[model samples]
Target: MAPKVTYSDLVIIGAGPAGLMAAAWASRLGLNARILDDKVDRVQTGRADGLHVRTLEILDSFGLANAINEKAYQLREICSWVRAARLPLRAGYADCDKNPDPEDDSKIKRTERVRAKEEEHGRFCQLGIHQGFIEQNFIDFLRREGRLNVERNTATKSLQLDEALMSDHAAYPICLRIGRSTVTMNGDTADQGWRSPQEEIIKARYLVGADGGHSWTRDQVGIRLEGGKTKVHFGVVDIVPITDFPDIRISCSIHSTKTGSTMTFPREDRLVRFYVQLAETGSEGDDFDTSKVTPEMITEKASKILSPYKLSYKHCNWWSVYTVGQQCAPSFSKDGRVFLVGDAVHTHSPTMGAGMNVSMQDSYNLVWKLGQVIKGIAKPDILDTYNAERQSVAQTLIEMDREMCDFYEKGAGSDAHNYDEFYERFRTFLSGVGVEYGPNALVVPAREDGSRDSRSCTDLDKSRQTRGFSRRSLASKIPIGQRLPSFLVLNHSEANIVHVHSVLPADGRWRLLVLAGDISKASQMARLRILCERMDAPSSFLRTYTPEGDKVDSVIEVVTIHAAPRHKVELFSLPELLRPFDPKLGYDYWKCFANNNAGEEGDFDDAYAKWGVDKDEGCLIVIRPDQHVSLVCGLQEVEEVEQFFNTILVPQQRRKATAAACE
Candidate 1:
């Protein structure tokens, strides 16, 4: 019999934090997608809990920052020190803390609280939100923004590429078969154990395996995680403690002189977390059984590690033990149709809370590229950057984690090791702003002789060192290949004050920042008009590349920021292209801006000088949907600007519709 068939623009496996993010972005880009997982419902507790600053900024672009901020815990400082006072811990320390000095509490005396590096775009700094709530927020956004839902309890039985369909760029090349793992009635599972062959065939243009660390999807792709298990095993427990420990309310890492290291994390609802070091499960070759480890063992070990200062909990929220191992997949994608993301690509120790933050970031970088490809706005080749950019980051994180683990074992103090130096070196990594992709089709750098590079896309991993995004030495001080930095600017029409990034939301649309120099000058005005004419031309990249039935600026929005005083350029004087109009919506007021040179509200007008743009001659900047800078061209170089878009975008040919549609 012919197999049951279904069709979707995208199929995402594993409805965990990473999967939910991919689904949310698909919804944002208007892709018809479904999220699936073998699990019946979201995990209740005890999972990734750190939301670094950069992750929060990504959330801001998704327009879900306010909703998440209201329900999460804020961890401002991470304190670390050693506990060497041998006052004797409670009965919980039988096999922990090898040796302790009788009165050397100095190990715990010099305590230092670590404040993660900051980013201008990441306003929240850092938060300790629960993973479940993070998933729920994405679900709510999926329902509200994309009108989509997750298909729970559905396991992907198999997936293979349809090479016959591969030739057709528009067709779904990846075919996936899925079925409900456990039969259910009225949203309740009836059979605890059940089996079924593939009940449906999902033809998908793209498939994402955001499945997780032990992802079946990863195994299906035959990608190997290259890393050996280290001698560090940790038991983590989240609880509400009733104890005499003074640092219970604050985040702290207590390094026992002999009991190993215990990491403390402050969470929401007065709940605290402790990463208890388990010396018994040292390395992968050790005679240890994770199945035999219990929550009782974790809490008991935590108690003994506390020692001199009594420690116990009246409530235990959740517990788990994991052997720390650093590993990364050799490749993140195959044939540009099937891909792996999040934990599927890398896994390492959670010493610095890098697990979930990096996972969500992987999905954030991927979904938008896939969305544009499926929408026919971008070429399939854009998918090539996914693995190269992200894998480099994965490798960087592994090395950083290994470095931190080394210091954790060496002990912290003036005489022991300079833990602060190592921590400061990777300050941006923990903050999530350390990702920077090098020059390629998407990222254009300023030429050495002050000219713009017009080269097409190449798979160059310039950011392979795990450094932050590269910045152009533009007088405007804008950094190329990095998120558009934030500066306060007013809405030309609304007279409102907000960060420059707030106006440029991450809705999967490229931004053409037409930084028109002082519009009052004749030369600047002439240049602006010429660029506008090119943008408005029928054969122009902006006009021709937009998806069918969409406006010229739909895919590549043109927002104007001029150095002229806001009072001088009224909204009516400029072309409709700058401030576009929808017949039903009237005029678009958000696209135009001035440097605020009038200084009516302080230095908000110094954008020209602050951005490093000349008041006499401005330049054009192209920003990716992820907010990284792509190109910077001369103000009057209209052809160069066109080539920038033509390099990566596949211009959509306008088809003769059955009926004429008014612009």
Candidate 2:
């Protein structure tokens, strides 16, 4: 019989964190998505186990952080250890001169203790949990949502794109032939008779390749990774450590005098992961085989680097050999129909624990754009921003990884002092908080000339001189084209404390945050009322872009944060535009928030002050579905905000007509 055929809005070619995240995004946005992998089962043992602060924030947005926190190990401080005589001792360093072998140059001592997660970043600290658990969380979400199930033991036979159908807005142009096979990660197969293989044809509007560094989809699409490998080779082993190391429980980097460096990550369940640099590979490139490196060699190298202090393991869970390399695909997508995400497009050393975090974030940034385009809520042009935005981030990560690996390899020599400084400088980048998308269809340009120079709010000051408004002063702390920092605020109606991020879930809607200052004041009230009246008008973008039968706030939701005492201002007194009422459901009280600026320094900080918005004259900000601030303008600048959306969102009538015609 001929193979059965099916259709999906998106067909993801991997079931790792990146692919699962894409599937989750599609499910959340109500899109038909199919995800597959060749592996027979999810990762059962060690792989990419570190979760940085920004990653935690992303998980929190999906309501998965609390669960992860309960199971994962919270890594608070990173202790740097080195030979005591080799470097200048600082206040935080612990000198071990009293040791019997203190005169020996090989003996290492603790140099510094750096906090793994900055306090200002968020409530979450860096966490060490196996990659399998993270993938499981996304799988659970998929199952709970009744949206998808990963088709494991599946292999892609062939892929074809109908370039002719690409011009059609509603066409499923990408095609794939896939078959079931009991294939494992080691390229081994089960008995052929155990499960008879069946093939199927799948047509998709969009295709995503999250199939790791050796990506078949990337090759099928004709994209090439453009970089080279370094001479350094490292072996990582996850084991239940048995040691007298003073900082065994702490994450640390130890560089030996004669051997190499060892980076320790204390994981959950009393397990610790050690990344031990084994060799330089030198001129014997072809002869120096990484696959030949064993767990014993890794343990020995780790033991040497952590000299004097006993280091051993009773049981080893997993071990792998890796060569440091940096490479990225020139582009993330092809003809705007097929795309690459995560390790498919970028590869680098995993020493920084960024492989999984950056990979998941890539999907997080791309899928929402795909969701909007697939749902006909946004223009196809918005999809292009994914490549432009994520490519730069991947490139930056690659560079940082290269330097970090270099530090681990040779920093014990001349580069030792610079290591701490280097780490401190890019620590935010490592935590993933510093990622910023440049100007694109999604992120509004800072300059009147349509250029985006920096992701800093200060850059807007130079651009907005013509408007006589200091864009820097309007929202000085909240940088456009970056994720909004979370702060405490109170629900206007309930007077209950809440985190700003708790209110803004990762739903596919553009948030029009009306930072309407003290609304009890006449000037602020009048300005807000005028804006509300304009939004209430039929010609408003909020109305024009939202489908006819849908709720008013369906496409672009208005969430007002007023700088006023909760008891002083009643919820009903605010204009209806801020709290749209549905015929079936009553008024939307959750959309309004009151700035909690009690001077006593309680749970709530002065949000207005933190955001750098004046308590009397406020600003209007547009936050994307991914929670990145896209546009910042004066409250009365309604036309500018509309023009911003006009570039990306499609009018509801046109979208409906297109849908009907396609049907």
Candidate 3:
């Protein structure tokens, strides 16, 4: 008989980037999640190394970006090259010159020179950190949260999906077999441990395959990965070098025969990573002795690439040789209950530098939807969007890497040798500016203009008409479909400045921020109280001044814009809104309003300057808890918001029909 145990929710197959992120997000959403990996220790050595800007922003959500930035080797710029001798061909930052201006007085003009310098250097550069360091930080975060349990040195031998244990509301039921024992657990549980195959009969409502390219989960689900693999064998060697190549530079060069390519990137702790592509031709199944790749061979290869520049390596830290390949699964999910993410879903050549970022993002996109489904706020079919959204991203990444390989390996004399064009494409891809969701994606509506009065009045005309005498502060009005800007505020008693996120409940509840002036207005306050009660959302009221003779609800935090002498409620002035809200402040403010520069030199001020506003007045904007805008509506349309949520949360009749067909 199989021993059985159950769980609270969620079982992730791998503890790599995708699985780790899934666990972290699940914990943040108040779910009990367990992670299992075959390795005895967290991946502490060689892996992917580049972190893109957008990935940095996502990490910011978890408050890890700043920490990463501090420790990471900032590749703020890159020098291009034709060969070892003519290399470091300085071209101005590609992105800086992309957006040019004519007017001298424009904000764009003020930063143009700086932009030029960065262009001559490189703009929007990626950071180079060992994948091991990133994994360590994530592991530390999970440990600090005290919510994640990682099972090490444990391999999953087999899995069984139980049809009877499955629910009409869930996609599937899974029974997993470990080494010897079977322990039953649902999608939600903190029951993470290593058990024998005999104890493996434990059941789960859902399963995520983040197990990587050689994914056991993918095989268990019978998903075939379809893509051609490359014959190139690349060796990576990390060493603490005693050399004079600027530690800040990432040098990539092609050897004389163009048979091999060598690239170097700086790492923390006086270390550098060297990647050398070995030239060998044989049948597809030919196995080269990768064990022969040593520190001396790597140094010899580096010296050849650097040539006149002279390079050497002494203190070796870690070294490994592995073949490079490209492959991606046709689908990201199978049977609704089993989902594939990260390398399990897609694998590509390392040339494009997108592996780690893409893997983490896959988890990011899926976690929120999964949370909604588990909480019963969204239907099971909502999970279908994950594959639809991420598959395209994976395909694009594969294509980009293929192009990069052609550029690097085929020599500049080839037909694909348009270095300038290739560089432009690289900039655009790395900028994260072009990533757009499909029509089926959820989009937030942004304001149409940057005018201060766009929020309060039904139309801009009325607000403009009364501008001088009764101009409403932007603070007292909330824009539709955009995230509320955060600001620093003193407690209503004028004691301390608290960050807005500090006041938020850690359990992932939605909030309604009310920018009201006088709580003494019994009718308005009553309406707000009723709205809060109906929405089951928390409300915080802010005002410029406290009414001299009115009683306010002490339970709700009441912040004043003016001076005060209390400790409970927060206070902030209008000027604070123009400044970036530090997270240490108790007020949650949007970063869009702080500065127009996106790490670029010039400020290309546009209507979307503060949250990409692009619609007329009297419109209501509803944003997802993740801060992505979901719906835009016309004035006073609470029912529309409710309808939108219902449509998204509940599986449509058509989706239900499809699921029935698949079953």
Query: Best lDDT goes to which candidate?
Result: 2
Candidate 1: lDDT over CA atoms?
A: 0.75
Off by over 4 Å in 3: 84-125, 164-167, 170-172, 180-198, 244-248, 251-259, 280-289, 411-420, 431-433, 441-620, 625-627, 633-640, 650-663
Model 1: worst 10 consecutive residues (lDDT sum): 461-470
Judge candidate 2 at residue 542 and give its lDDT: 89
Full-model lDDT, candidate 2: 0.81
Superposition TM-score, candidate 2 onto the true structure? 0.93
Question: What are the per-residue Cα lDDT tens digits for candidate 2 across 440-486?
Answer: 55666555424536432322322232232225457888776788888
Better of 1 and 3 by lDDT: 1
lDDT against the true structure, per candidate, is 0.75, 0.81, 0.54
For candidate 3, which ten residues in a row score worst on lDDT? 107-116
Q: After superposition, how far is residue 352 of candidate 2 from its true place, in Å?
A: 0.8
Q: What tens-digit string does per-residue lDDT give for candidate 1 at 425-472?
A: 777777776676646656655555124433323464233232122224
Provide C-alpha RMSD values for all models, in order: 6.3, 3.6, 12.1
Once model 1 is optimally superposed onto the true structure by TM-score, how far is the C-alpha of residue 543 displaced, in angstroms?
1.0
Task: Give the CA lDDT, 0 to 100, for residue 430 in model 3.
Answer: 51
